[model samples]
Target: MNRSENTATSAAPAKITDSGQFKRSLGTWSTLALGVGAMVGFGWVTLVGGWINDAGTLGAASAMLAGGVMMAVVAFVYSEMVAAMPKAGGEHNYILRAMGPRWSFIGSWGITGGYATVVAFEAVALPTALEYVIPLDHLHLWTVSDSDVFLSWALVGAVTAVIITIINIVGVKIAGSFQMFVVLFLFLIGFLQIFGSLNAGEVSMMEPLFSNGWAGFFTVLVVVPFMFVGFDVIPQTAEEVNLPPKKTGRIAFISVIIAAAWYIMIILTVSSALTPEQQANSSLPAADAMATLFSSEFFGNLMVAAGVAGIVTSWNSLQMGASRLMYSLAQGGMLPAWLGKLHPKFGTPVNALLVLGAVATIAPFFGHKALGWIVDAGSPMIVIAYFLVSISFVILRIREPKMNRPLRVGGRGNFGVIVGATAVAITAFLITLYVPGMPAGLSIEPWIIFGVWWLVGAVFFVGIPGGVKPGPNAEEELMEKVYARYPHRRP
Candidate 1:
């Protein structure tokens, strides 16, 4: 497509000083760290034992590999769309262009929920990790879902939530730097596990690798997408990335590969270091496995500390991703305009960040029992967004054949269509896993939460004005309608 045609299809290039725009300051390493850090959060530290029990070591690792491949396909679809659009709200922009505003709202809302849930998950997860290192005094608070809510424990997470929110509100650069620093510790923990496994791991400990057979494997497989959910943060912050569009796409894809390798290695290391009996008995298998391999409690504490770092990284990135997504939605008039307002000095989405941060802060009070429900509820939402994005990919390929895609997935012609179609099929199949009878079906609580979230989204969908076409002036048209609805806010 010519420059004129591209301009008509895509948003104008972002400027550093433009009002309500993200500052372009994120470098290659920071960008990669954002994606990697988001994916390699505390899940491995706390949930490894459950995975081992469900599918055994090898079975779990296989499930992770399979899920990673499926995500990689989705990543490719994201890469192509992000390269072509390179806007703030990753899926929102692509779906809006290809499928129009209503679908865009649905896709964007799905991802926003996914990111927001992770933000809350990390808030609870941070305190949980810290408890392994230094036990917090449980000041008796009420119990929810049979889990005690302690004031002291909840305070730790709530305080950290405030700090993370401040870091993000200060600037994307600061948040990216924090993410990079924390991610180094995450890498350190991974290397220690790998080294320990090589030095003292026992192959015999990996016996009965298949566990409960296909049923167990499928259970583990269903959660794989949730584990690798953070890579899409790259596209959400694409406007701030300093690299070329093609390079940005490549980094997003590479992050997925790194995360896949990270998870598989963790499973192997844990399996080799601990017997099945030990794993079953342990609360934190990965940490215990490291401590066992090294023969020191200090190493175990270090693993927990690294897990805390992982929590911070995930919290920071997801908060950033969620806010940008909200900003994008608001900017398009799908949400209230206040969320679109950037911090006058920091150039970050202040309202969006604050709103999400408030949710994160309150999440800790709900205690750890809510974490599972939040996670399960968020998984299908993430897949829903991915499914829509895949559909958008196919739509754009067929409708806008000459649209510029810097990092084209299958290069040109019918092959790109085939790749997109494959992504659509894979995501569609993955979505079915959440059905009530499916092996990976969500529990009752999560099902209720998921239903309520979409029902709320449906209200927003119906409230927005009709006939807002997706193009250069789409935002303006929607904004005008928004102002018409709430004239007092117009300026």
Candidate 2:
């Protein structure tokens, strides 16, 4: 295992240097809201429609459940780690402390790569959503090509990225508030659909529920993990929290439960409402499915609003998460020194946000389908990072037995932690491998894209001049900090 980079020693933590006026006072609810904001939008709303279209309704639902189970296990593993570590850079920080700096560099890239692909997914979908709600015929003057829709989508993506970058740079409080409102609204709308559909709508029995073969269910399972990845953002903001451990554990677990229940209701209602032909045919199947229960225009407008809001929140939350990881890396001497500088006025990581936004904004020109391909290809790396974190949990338990854990995983000694972590790690990897090759319509080859992304990060992390030099007593320093704050309790 390679050593971790933790050498950059400032006089004190950077938070002490800033005025701290713009520092966020977010708690469990806000963190949960951000997680829901990141994950709930397109994946649950529009993308579920797409998945169902490709695989039958039953196939997609089965896949969703399989993915959810894997996600639940991984979430438990991560919860244990976050409860112990409770800092920025998330898996980057965990992997380094356990495996070494070299692997940490790869972990950092894995996280950033995931965020960039998510941005691409949101950017591409935002415009397609707009066209569904409002026709762009009058604005044909701005159209550049035979495919006016494609041009419109690209512009929309770029514009959305700019807006989200500004929100992220402003700091977490504003961003958290925005996400809270959007996610709350999303939940309300979902609940409304459940109740409303039950009252007036004739729920047709989806006979032969397990319509998709075992292969199709497994295929959908691979793709479904991407939906859960966005929730990792909650724990990444641990440093910014007023109470890190309490807030992280409470928010993360609760948010997962809420999201799961909401998703179940949505799949049941939408699937039951629409016929197989209707589900397969429409691009915006959710809107069409709901239209049978409600008026067409009303359903379409509601979904468009939800989709737009979801993308904005997802983009903003991801921008914040990715930028913080950069700050953590730079402060550790893994990257350029300038990136460690927080914005003077806002106390936010402005430089990192700008860089992340630039990469994300450029991805949409390839079109919506291509953006989906990018997200799919990037998905494997994130699962790998989670698997590493799960492994790290057990290694850290044995290596740093005396290190104070503010929030400890309960059981006889470290046995439970090891078992939970190993289970989560193996399950995530297995699911990632289980999903078959990408469907025909998607652009990038899944294996090839995943390979290139990993290769590029490996070279940059190891080859570059400031290639993550490991610090002496890195683990000791972290242990001291942990113990000072959280003295071990005797049973």
The TM-scores, one per candidate, come to: 0.95, 0.84
lDDT of 1 by residue, 377-449 (tens): 9988998899999998998888777777778889887888888898999889989999988878888999999
Per-model CA lDDT versus the true structure: 0.86, 0.65
lDDT of 1: 0.86
| Pairs in clash, predicted candidate 1 | none
Best by lDDT: 1
Location of the lowest summed lDDT over 10 successive residues in candidate 2: 3-12
Return the TM-score for candidate 1, rounded to 2 decimals. 0.95
Model 2, residue pairs in steric clash: 2-100, 3-101, 4-101
lDDT of 2 at 68: 71
